[model samples]
Target: MSEALAVVETAGTDTTVPAVSGARQFWRRLRAQRAALVAAAVVALLVLVALAAPLLTALEGQDPTTYHPALIDSARGGVPLGSFGGVSAEHWLGVEPQTGRDMFARLVYGARVSLGVSLGATVVQVAVGIAMGVAAGLGNRWVDLVLSRITDIFVSMPLMIMALALLAIVPNTFPRPVLVALIIALVAGWSTMAKMVRAQTLTLKNLDYVAAARLSGWKTWRIAVRELLPGLAAPGITYAALLIPSNISAEAALSFLGVGVKPPTPSWGQMLTSADVWYQAAPQYLLLPAAALFVTVFALTVLGDGVRVALDPRAASRLRVGTGRRRENRARAAVPENALPEKALPVKSLPEKEGPA
Candidate 1:
């Protein structure tokens, strides 16, 4: 058993487990950050709430449109505002100005639309980006050159202006908010992914693993996925996740400008729009949605930053300095029990080379 354990340890056959352990280590590092963990927990709970949003008010047919004026009209009715306007049970966050809509229910319902657009846009972005990236990556030199230049052209295009222009051209009947988001995101997403994939592909094209596979006569797509893609997974996940916030922001901006998700639908931006007329009279109505937007964006950005830091090889190297001495001590104690003696040589300047001359 001991000999088998030593063989397994020395032969380095459990390479696949490192991927799993690295993921575990990432979560462990994230957990070490108390604030980030709490923020992450809140984000998770929000995701759950967003998923069950339909059940919260759907069965009885309650929606953002559900208005209760008599309760809202009272100075201290069932709806109460918190510190923003003082807590009330009747219409939490108070009622919308003049309309007396249940801001609480509307806020909850808005989660669906906000999350839907954000997620849907992200899905489209990742799909289109990955396809474009992979195509640009696999193409010949001239193909890569032309594709890259096209990406640059799109990069130079004014995104918001383009979305507005495209929306105007595609009749309002056809350019629904989701379609608008998909189009705008596709343009931005493809360009960004193409550039990144090109750079990565250029670096990876000659990597030992990919080269070995290619030399073995593996099909191009098989080598691309089996060897090249695993290396790209870290960046791919991080980038796709980060792009979500941008999509959400675009949705909100378009909604604010009256070109986004149609009104009457519960959306963060549309929710805020309802208060545009009397922000002074009913500040809670506006502030709540805006705060929600800010928190969601902030959480996603920080989470993305954390993933980038953890995924980076250089960042992972920091663990050595912090834990090196302890590991060294353990190895020293275990040295006598092993067949080979450990040396005190510096790694970067190893003095010995074992080979036939």
Candidate 2:
């Protein structure tokens, strides 16, 4: 008995479960989400297409700026001559209604501008938001007050009006896409991210590890960089993912308003601006850019939601959504039969008492 007990003790002591790193765990969770995976694939394709725009355009034998006047019918209000907006062997998508610029070339090139502006704007917003949020959360009372007020002021400002004013004032010499991105980042939206970060910081600062770090005489900067930033990353990333689609839409809106990327530059919004007039005569012109914008935005939104669920599984549970049903089933299957709850186990009924024996 003593030997058996010793063996049991040694076996128990030696048994160890391997620890999973956060990155691996996150990736594992993200992979389980089918919608997220699909969305990721779409976003990847868009990025790939955007990066390969020049090569694609070269192969199509068309440049976005070159106009083929012969393809347009002046009798029909400058509409493309052939069916479906002049689609042919040469033009995979079709030609523009009036200018006869290759739709495929303009679309791929437009992807570059749209993606670049939104991505750049998102980066700027994240940087500014993190800086402001962390400062407000970690700073003294007076510092917090000032930052909070500043954030409020930013939130209160009308984004469209501010963007228009700024865009109007800036010299036209600067690259329009870059200028639009900067304007979008500066105008509004960062306040929400800042607020979220600030709240998270406040909660994290009061935690035991943070308190221990402070007691160990670590400086504010060091503690923030080492301790607080890691905790902030999950939420920050989730928020940033959601922010991209919004920024893209905002850029499109700006372009639609004639204050966005200027002509000769093929932005989806600018395309839409021109497409409006040709909707009745050549509906294909309007549909193409609109569909592209819709798909990109929809994919991004779904991906963001998946990312949010992956980063915080509890969030899915809280919403009563079955996002992890497959994961849950796999987990359950991995557990030994004996480890299952008693309620889940088969129960044998006791022999019924003989009646009137």
Candidate 3:
């Protein structure tokens, strides 16, 4: 009996469970959230649309800059003619009020500018933030103080006002989208990321592995690159995901205020700027770009939240909230009974027939 029990215990111990990698686990958790998956799909579609702007415009046989005067009603303040803002076979999404530019063409092309600036700005912000954050976290007392104070100063400044002031002074000779992205990055984009990184670094630097690395005579740069950076990636990626929508909104606000991308380039915000005056005459003009912005922002925000939850172990419970029962059932079915803990094993009752006999 003792030998049999030992054999059973060894069998249980010998069963090898396949290890799931961190990336795979994260992907699984993210995929489990239906809303996040849908949002991801929507974001992907928008990105595809943005990237294929020229192809889409070419297929529509309309250039963003070309005007179709006949499609507009000059007699009535250049309101688009026909029903639904002049939407027809030739112009799939109708034409602009005064200019008669193809709405579809402008919208698809505008996506390129909006997404380009937002994504570019995000990259700049994240790069600068990590550099500043690591420097502050790893440096001595005075270094931390200087960087932290600078970060606080940037955080406190009025973002919109500073962006406006800076953009207004910059020469338009520079590539508009790149200039806008850089200005956005400079004014207010990086402070949050830096702060988060600094806090995380301060905590991570005290860990045993980091100390071990230090004792191993590793340089500060090497420790930061090899030790701290991997630890920082999760939060950095999560924060970066959240930052994209904010940057998109900022870009739109700047453009709507006439300080962003100029005309002929066709940004969503620039479209909204023109759309504002035409709301009474042509609601589609306002509604199209407004809806596009709302959908993109909403989708991005949802996806970002999903990423945050997926990356955080503490938040794992939140993802399981609605699907708890199904997940539990699936887990119970998938896990072999023998692989369960010894404490969970069934206890066999001794035979009592011999005593009665």
Q: What is the lDDT of residue 308 in candidate 1?
A: 62
Off by over 4 Å in 2: 1-11, 317-357
Question: CA shift at 41, candidate 1, in angstroms?
Answer: 1.0
Alpha-carbon deviation at 139 in model 2, angstroms: 0.8
Candidate 1 residue spans exceeding 4 A from truth: 1-20, 58-62, 69-88, 172-177, 316-357
lDDT for residue 268 in candidate 1, whole number 0-100: 86
| lDDT string, candidate 1, 1-357, tens digits | 122122234476643222246677777776655555666776787788788877865643455786556544366433323444433644445566555666666777777777777788777777666666766787788887888788899888877787777766766666375775676676676578767876787788788888898889998789778887877778788787678778778888877777777756677887766567656656777789999899888777766666666666456432234566777888778877666756777659667888997
lDDT tens per residue, model 3, 1-357: 122122233545754344667788899988878889999999999999999998998998899999999999999999999999999999999999999999999999999998999999999999999999999999999999999999999889888999888888888898889988998887786998999999999999999999999999999999999999999999999989988999999999999999999988999999999787899899999999999999999999999989998899577633346688888899989999998776766889988766654
lDDT by residue (tens digit), candidate 2, 1-357 = 122122233645854444566777789988977788999999999999999999999998998999999999988778898888889989988899878899999999999999999999999999999999999999999999999999999999988899988989888899999999998997776898999999999999999999999999999999999999999999999999999999999999999999999999999999999788889888988999999999999999999998998899777623226646867898999999998877756889999888995
- Residue 259 Cα positional deviation in candidate 1, in Å, after optimal superposition: 0.2
Question: Clashes in candidate 3: how many?
Answer: 0
C-alpha lDDT of all candidate models, in order: 0.70, 0.91, 0.91
lDDT of model 1 at residue 322? Answer: 53
Report lDDT (Cα) of residue 16, candidate 3: 38
